[model samples]
Target chain A: MKDVYFMERDPYAPIRHCYGISKILYEGKSKYQEIQVVESHYFGKILILDGVVQFTEKNEFFYHEMLTHPVMFAHKNPQNVLIIGGGDGGILREVLKHKSVKKAVLVDIDKDVVEVSKKFFPTVACSMDDPRAIILNEDGFKYIQDYKNEFDVIIVDSTDPVGFAHVLTTEEFFKYVFEALKEDGIYVGQSESLHYHLDIVVRFQKALKKSFPIVDLYTTVIPVYAGYWWSFSVGSKVYNPREISREVDVETRFYSDEIHKNAFLPPNFYQKILNGNFKY
Target chain B: MKDVYFMERDPYAPIRHCYGISKILYEGKSKYQEIQVVESHYFGKILILDGVVQFTEKNEFFYHEMLTHPVMFAHKNPQNVLIIGGGDGGILREVLKHKSVKKAVLVDIDKDVVEVSKKFFPTVACSMDDPRAIILNEDGFKYIQDYKNEFDVIIVDSTDPVGFAHVLTTEEFFKYVFEALKEDGIYVGQSESLHYHLDIVVRFQKALKKSFPIVDLYTTVIPVYAGYWWSFSVGSKVYNPREISREVDVETRFYSDEIHKNAFLPPNFYQKILNGNFKY
Candidate 1:
């Protein structure tokens, strides 16, 4: 068989990441965006939304684990956990691994993304049937406005901050997130690539710093992403993700006790990034 | 001007990185390989050897600093340093930063690679003519066999472990390297990408472990590299690269004392990688 490549062009970056596609397993347009499930020789199944790689079966764990467990393990008692915009169920799967988590709520506005993910990615969408997971097919921003000091940990797994997910990275949304969290709640979100989106990361940190007492950044390499050095921003009322408060007895290939401590950028990186004093 | 892209294809990985090029400044067939210097709108000047990108002016510091300083700082005093196959002189520039380093020698077999770099990449090749820096255009393997416990630090910034550079990553060459370093000396080399070249990294580490008592891995991200998580293998007789023995007082855009400590992999990663106990 000849080869076919999917070129995922970044909106602003001067590079276009090309992925080899073996076959198109499923292709259809959702209400908010076009969706496709494709088979890759190296990466197994890949989920694409609006010509952007959402995740692949081979390395989704890097993105999902880094985004989920750091915040989950940071809090001393993360009983009530909330994941925003992770319709793919990968975050839910990771969240359910925490024994301390009593109720895990997942909120995504796009119901079609959830339906498609459930139909195509069974292993990645594995935790949908778990007893503790609560699914909400509604706008997370509107849904979050009604709460006050509710969740112990809140994670935003939204797409890049250029679309409907744009509001989620704003000061107003962070203020809403501040109101929705407990006195000691921790908020974590994908802050995009630190190499390509340093401006966006600093913006997110600045906005979160207004509401949360502690804000820092950590990153992991996801091969599918353009810059590969994908960043995750953390906002906490008390816990600093660089230091884990709880002992991790969970099963994870990438995030270990050492990795948790090592994943964080040194204080100098945050100083340079947040203060807009650095350049790539 | 119309846009042109330089497509970098890895022999194994499924992805081909595309960088936007403004113009091809020079193209010629060297005695050993074909070389081209191209100007990029985003990455400044890019040096490509035989269709593979050597370094771009934009982010070479990420690679050069990580490969050089980890071991350089780990050594209490690195008076004499030797570099193998770093024709581009990025490593030489970083080696001269240490105040303790008195004599820095760079040996690359390809004279054209050095000549081309000196012409097109003046800023990156800035330290090639420094009083303390020495250039030797000769076969490194032959030159290395003459030394016995002479150099304080030896760095192998060779190309990927393919073609002529293959010999540099073998057990035999590591033995030569082990014999060439003083009792308290340190060694470092680019071990390729962690994601795409895990087996190569493990193999290099395993080989170095035979001759050196302490061997570890460190990495930095390069956007030009297929896998942005680039790995550098360190072998030392007395120094542990994770902890620095000397204070770093260099003017760098990327490397700092915090970065020096942060660049090395956590102990768990080394354990998992060395035992071949993990998979991506």
Candidate 2:
């Protein structure tokens, strides 16, 4: 059979990526963004939103595990967890791995993403039906306004900070998140790449520093992402992310005790990145 | 002006990259490979070898500093160094930064790359005329066979292990490299990306292990590289690469005291990668 290629159309990235597709599983428009599912010859089944790849079956574990486990293991005991904009349920599946968590609240502005994930990505969307899961189809920014010091952990697993998601990185949204978290609560959000989005990362870190006592950054490599060196910004009210406070016993493909320590950027490199000392 | 895109045609990589070129500076076939220089809108001037990106002025420091400094600092005092296949002279520029090094030898099969780099990439090719530098136009595989326990450090800065460069990763070639090094000498080489080239990395590590006391893997993210998460395999006769034996007093954009310690992959992760336990 001849091969068909899916060329990504990412306006923000200087370089683009092309994946060889074996078959197209689904393609449609969600109320929020364009949705696509294809069986790739190299990366297996992939999920694309508005021409940007979210994850693939072959390497989603690296993204999902790195994003979920580091913050989960940092907290002493996270019983109440909240996830923003993760309609795909990959974060929900990982959050449920911690036995201490009694409830997980997921709020996404788009209902179509959840429905499509349930129909096409069954394994990734497995935790949506769990007894501890609470699904809310609403604006996550407005949803957090009702609570004050209620949740132990808040994960912003949204798309790139563009269009509807741009507000998620603003100072106002960070203030709301600070008010919604407990005194010892931790907040983590996907902060884009350190290579292409260093300015945005510095802006986000500056905003995070205004709201939290301890702000840190960690990184992982996701091949599907246009900027392959993906970054995550963390804001803590009291805990230090450098040391894993709790023991990690979860079954993961990429996260471990040593990896947690190694995932963070060294202090000198981090300072250099923020100061714009390193040229890309 | 209209934009022209240069889509990389890498056979080994499952996905390909496309760079937006503002102008083509040079394009011709050398004795060994096709070389091209173009002005990229995002990455500044970029050097393309046989349709694959060799380096860009915007981000070449990340690759050169990461590849050269770690091995240089690991040794207590490196007086004689041998570099194979770094025709662009970026590695030579970095090697000359060390004041303790008395002599530096560079061997590459192609002379056109060096001439083009001297004309187009002056900053990278600046060290070609240094008093202690020796530029050789010969095959590295054949040239290294003449030396025995003569050099303190050997760096393989070759292109992908394909076409004419495939022998650089073989056990036979590694034996020659081991014979060319001093008793406590160090060897470092570009082992390809950890994302798509795990099997190649494992083969290189296994080959290094047979010839050295310690074989370690370190990583850095190079944006121009298709698999951004690139790996480097290091083989040391006596020193453990985890700790820096000499103080890093050189001026660098990426390598630092903290970075050198953190660049190495943890033991568990390395074991998992070699065992093929981690999927993507």
Candidate 2, superposed: residue stretches over 4 Å from native: A1-3
Q: What is the interface RMSD of candidate 2, in Å?
A: 1.2
Candidate 1's docking class is medium
Worst 10 residues of 1 chain A by lDDT: A1-10
Q: How many backbone clashes does candidate 2 have?
A: 1
Cα-based lDDT for every prediction: 0.87, 0.91
Query: Model 2, B3-89: lDDT tens per residue?
Result: 578889887898988888889999999888999999988998999998899999998999999999999999999999999989999
Q: In model 1, what are the clashing residue pairs, if there are any?
A: none
lDDT of candidate 1 over A22-133, digit per residue (tens): 8988888877778888888788899988888999988898888889999889899899998899999999999999999999999998888898889989988999989999
lDDT of 1 by residue, B1-280 (tens): 4567878766756777788888989999977778899888888999888788888888888888888888988889999999999899999999998889899989999999999989999888899989999899998988999999999999998887778888999988999999999999999988988888899889899999999999888888877788889888889998878888887877788888898888888887778888888767
TM-scores of chain A across candidates: 0.97, 0.98
Please give the RMSD of candidate 1 to the true structure: 1.4
Each prediction's total of clashing residue pairs, residues at least 3 apart in sequence or on different chains, is 0, 1
Best by DockQ: 2
Where model 1 places Cα greater than 4 Å from the true spot, the runs are: none
lDDT of 2: 0.91
